[model samples]
Target: MPDSFGRYPNMNISEYLDFFARAYGLRGASRREAVERVPDFTELGDLVNKPIDTLSKGMSQRLCPGRTLIHDPDVLILDEPAAGLDPRARVELRELIRLLASKLQKPGPDQLTHSHRAG
Candidate 1:
C-alpha cells in the first residue's frame, strides 16, 4: 500500500488527498476538510499545488502516512511510517503518533467520573 502513493504521479496534493478521502467514503464538508488538512498534516502545505511526482523522498514519506490516516482508523498498523524521512520528519512523525495515542487513550468525562466513583 505504501507504493500506492505514486499510482497517480501527476495528481497534485489536493487531488491526491481528495481521491483517498472519497475512497474512504468521505463527502461534502468532511471530504473537503480532509483534503485541506492532509497537506498540513504531511507538512506539504507549501507544495500542495505541486504534482506528486515532484515530491522528494521525505515529502513522499510523510504524504503516504497522511493518506493512511485520513480515515482515522481505530487501530493503525504501520510497518515503518518514517522509514525514509529525515531527522526532522521522524521527529514530527513521533510527535504525531504520541498525540494520536494520547487522544485515543483519554477517557470521556462520563467515563472519568465513573472510574473515580468505582475507585
Candidate 2:
C-alpha cells in the first residue's frame, strides 16, 4: 500500500475518492456521497491539485483516513486519526469512521454475532 502522503495527487478530491472507493467495493453514487461529507473536503479536493507537502498538518491528517477508506479494506488500522484535529473536526471524523466500519461489512446478518449467540 502507498504511504498516506503518496495517495492524494494532482486529481480532484472527488476523483481520488472515487478511485479509492472503487478499490474497495462501494459503487456508483453512494461512495461519492460519503466522501463529500468530509469537512472542508471540497477545498481539500481543490488543494489536491497542489503538492501534498504544501497542505497544513491537519489537512494532511484528515486526508490520510480518506485515502485509507478509499481501498475499503476488510480491516482498517488507524493510528491517532484524531491526534491534531479540533473538537468538532475530531467528532465529525469519528462519525465518518464509524460509518465506514458499518459500510465495509458484506451486508449480512453479521455471522460473528450469530455464532456467538448460537454457541
TM-score of each prediction? 0.71, 0.47
Q: Write the per-residue lDDT of candidate 2 for residues 1-119, one digit (tens) a residue.
A: 22235545466555666666776776767776655644243236556445555666666666666667554455555555666567776666666556654654353122111111111
RMSD of each: 9.2, 8.4
Give the Cα error of residue 115 in candidate 1, in Å. 35
Measured with C-alpha atoms, the lDDT of residue 87 in candidate 1 is: 69
Residue range 50-96, candidate 1, lDDT tens digits = 99888877677767767877766655555555665666766776566
List clashing residue pairs in candidate 2: 20-70
lDDT of 2: 0.54
- The window of 10 residues in a row where model 2 has the poorest summed lDDT is 110-119
Q: After superposition, how far is residue 4 of candidate 1 from its true place, in Å?
A: 7.3
Cα RMSD, model 2: 8.4
Candidate 1's C-alpha runs over 4 A off are 1-4, 86-88, 99-119
- Which candidate has the highest lDDT of all? 1
